[model samples]
Target: KMSKEKIDLLKLMGANVILTRSDVSRGHPDYYLDMAERLSQQRGLFYTNQFANNANIEAHYRTTGPELWQQTEGRINAFVCGVGTGGTLTGVGRYLKEQSPDIEMVLADPEGSLLADKVNGLSAKLPGSWLVEGIGEDFVPDNCDLSIADHAFTVSDQDAFMYTQALFSRELILAGTSTGVLLTAALRYCQQQTEPKVVVTLACDTGYRYLSKAFNHQWLERHHLTGDLEGL
Candidate 1:
């Protein structure tokens, strides 16, 4: 896990990194709570569960919400985003809803994720996997308030990766794969709108971290992404 090795390096710099079992899909949020409980019983574990933590949400409420409000001059008609920890959406959604309850908060979900189903009140399907990292879930995190989302869009892996590459070429922004999913959904939301509206989504991470996967042609081919995109 070269990506997580960065967290290990942080440990060397006195950042306490608690090693947990690999929970790939976020299918069961309980696994993390159980892990925390088990570890707490064994040792002096200070579990800062960011998933349900108010502080995590408040940080964005205070910082991101105000900044977006000011930057957009309060003309933000819509906010779309993918969920990793659910903090950003929860915080920003809370703030925006407070400002104007009429504002749209749309959830940009990966096709394989059950979250969109949850938000839309559809029956859950068998969970699947996607190439986009740091978003999509098999189970809703505690911080995910689906009421915030006026609508949801389920993006395919191909669509997500295609938009990711497009961002690199079109905007010169090497955005992460999850950001692509969000942006794709956001664009779709924009197109479907009846009136002129200001829609916003975020570039969640740098694409430099994904150079060996999403940015690699061989990896794309292996995953059948480029082929799928060509068909699209």
Candidate 2:
């Protein structure tokens, strides 16, 4: 997709180039890094911005906490989120802590992700595998601060997909798989709370991007993602 877009842009500028997508790059992280390097070398331009650091995490966390607080009329007492870039969790956790020292920050992780175990101070091991993308990681990112998370829940891909679909159907709000994981974690937290605490979680991205994958039963069946759809 990026290659196609780049080629179109160049064509608009009256430049001719041949570009091809390569599978030699492994994983999203490596692919992004390789693309950046290639673009810099080809265009004599380099990005000045920091790539993988904690600053973005902190900023996002701060924004999320305040927004939740305001949205819930300052009654929010807990938060649940999944970490991809880690900016959202770290930043929001910090902000929530500052606003109300007792607010609990919960990390929702996809099954087989290292984050939940890491946050709980468990021994690091090889991350398990899950179908859910974005929220699960083979390794903990630098921006994720486990210290801020009071608890963590590892959700299965099946659960994530079903919950997200149900959320859209029932609430009329389309959200991504990560959001479903977060919402499930939040509900668990809410159930455990003794009082009526306002718990919050992010909607993350829209669900449309996943329509061809999670939302389509045909796609799900083709990929064997259809087991126990009701559980999600």
| Highest TM-score scorer | 1
Q: Which ten residues in a row have the lowest lDDT in candidate 1?
A: 21-30
For all candidates in order, the CA lDDT equals 0.81, 0.74
Q: What tens digits encode model 2's per-residue C-alpha lDDT throughout 97-196?
A: 8888898889999888888988888898877667665676665566767788999988877778778888887898987777888888888777788878
Per-model TM-score, in order, reads 0.85, 0.78
Write candidate 1's Cα lDDT for 152-232 as tens digits: 999998889898988888779997888989989999998898889999899998887788778889988888888434343
Q: What ranges in model 1 sit over 4 Å off?
A: 1-33, 227-232
lDDT of 1: 0.81
Error of 1 at 119 (Å): 1.5
